[model samples]
Target: MYVAVKGGERAIENAHAWLAEERRGDKGVAELSVAQIREQLSLAVNRVMAEGSLYDPDLAALAIKQARGDLIEAIFLVRAYRTTLPRLGASKPVETGEMACDRRISATFKDVPGGQLLGPTFDYTHRLLDFALDAEGEIPEAQSGEPQAAPVPHITGFLNRDGMIEQEPQGDATPPDLTREPMEFPANRALRLQNLTRGDEGFVLGLAYSTQRGYARNHAFVGELRVGTVPVEMEIPELGFAIEIGELRLTECETVNQFKGSKTEPPQFTRGYGLTFGMTERKAISMALVDRALRWRELGEDDLGAAAQDEEFVLAHSDNIQATGFLEHIKLPHYVDFQSELELVRRLRREAQATRQDQQEAAE
Candidate 1:
């Protein structure tokens, strides 16, 4: 029971002014440009775009700047702004097989077709902090390599050819848009994927960790993980054929999980798939693990009653914006509710005291 308070326009205006001032700090320092944030703080921009369910890097960077580097606040800003935009035609499903990969790796295979390209990765780097980055320093240019003539095929394709992994048939039905429609229980794989892709990274990562730590354990192996750019295409009414709209940088993870033979089906490995905007491999991998865990029922596995296995619980609580809004609302003007609670507690205490006195007098 939240009561609305009236007549604080002046205070609210003043607070807004103060907030604006605080957002831009240290007059002596040069103000950071949106371009700098877009390029330098790219990882932050990627996160805002992924969780905000918007892909515009410039807008994401601007949101980050306006939020004063508070990522969740930036995500909130992006989501709020996203509501005002008109819906253009949806793009045709991207062919990740055609990706111009920046990074591709496989823990399951040593010698793949593309030969395991390790583009720009931090995996091999020492954890030592470089003091040279404190001051502006010129760095040598990186060596370039010749582009591969052959397309990099997925590692899972190899297993599928041998009937070692469950095959996923392509679906032609349009996926439900959660933005326009309310989320319901027993969500389809597509809806679940949409929710997981835009879910809070920390929340998804924690759930994934729990699965790995023996909670509904589904022994998952990174069959293949790739980070790259793929072309987005949309069909025009006049053209009657899809044309390239733009390219999106994406991180995709495919995990192969152990699946014992069921009564009706032969023993074959199952897959967990995750795809996210920009280079968010950690989030992508986490999404994959959680996705696999949630498919336990459909996979004919026993109900371990894990948190990750609950579809309603995952979809409902995965949204940080909704969670934060509910949480932060409690801090605002609960005076009336508190007063009511206070009165009730006092009345109960007084009644108990009176009853105790009456009982004592009767005994005497």
Candidate 2:
């Protein structure tokens, strides 16, 4: 029997060993603890949870460490880990009106029924880097605010009093998951919002930025933004009622975009929705704009064909894990294809050279 090259199993094992070594880096250095990652790299963890569609900060922190601080890679890690988790039935759709907010703010009105609360935000922080982090000793003034906290109220309830915005329709009808279904044209609001929440932060930000640059320019204002935990409940047919399943920390942004009073329509404010994991205002704001842009067709607005307005383009390449994988994979071996192209060009040049020589000789 003719023998063939084997050791595929051994090669994988050796490769894994090398990868583990590379992941560890310097041998003598104390490894980065998961606690350190969770506390210090919280923003990274927030992003992983936001894009991975999972709210477990501990798991997200671990993924960040495993990815060696590559945030996109960290997101991929979280997504892979998230997918393996067992399904525990569907939770009842979150009631945002009932959310227990930690932070809430509004930019739309000066003084509403509920006073604007500028919750925990980095907006007022100085731009200088702190040198204190270089030292091991902790800051003496680290005041841990009461671990036992009260739930803050939502800011949008004030606007609802005057009916400034349209009241959202409540439905027990199950929402479709964009991940499970292949994207079809004319996506419903639920499906579109689902994709946008898990979409790549950078790509979404760019599309949102483009709107300000004039392509389907949507004049938008932050109607409200809130961050906190909301109870996720489940309605059991057997139980005949809903029960609380768990809670999730989320940042929700609703932008009030410009709309004209049409001949048949009344002057009503349009909504741009963004709901993401953790305290991520910028991402939430960007998401809202992109969300609004995607709804142009449904809103009876002209098809400007803007990048943000293109559902197929935006939804298809929105996930960082998918984009990064496809983009980075191109760096791997493509030698065979390169060799064939190289030979084809070389043969074409040689033929051209002979043809030129023949023409010159005939003229002589």
Please give the range of 10 consecutive residues that has the lowest summed lDDT in model 2.
142-151
Off by over 4 Å in 2: 1-19, 25-28, 136-164, 167-170, 236-241, 262-264, 350-364
Q: How accurate locally, in lDDT, is each candidate?
A: 0.93, 0.81
lDDT of 1 by residue, 179-256 (tens): 989998889889999999999999999999999999999999999999999999999989889899999999999999
In the predicted model 1, the residue pairs found to clash are: none
The CA-based lDDT of model 1 is what?
0.93
lDDT computed for candidate 2: 0.81
Candidate 2 residue pairs in backbone clash: none
- Count of backbone collisions within predicted model 2: 0
**Model 2 compared with the native: what TM-score?**
0.86
Give me candidate 1's TM-score against the actual structure: 0.97
Alpha carbon lDDT at 132, candidate 2: 82
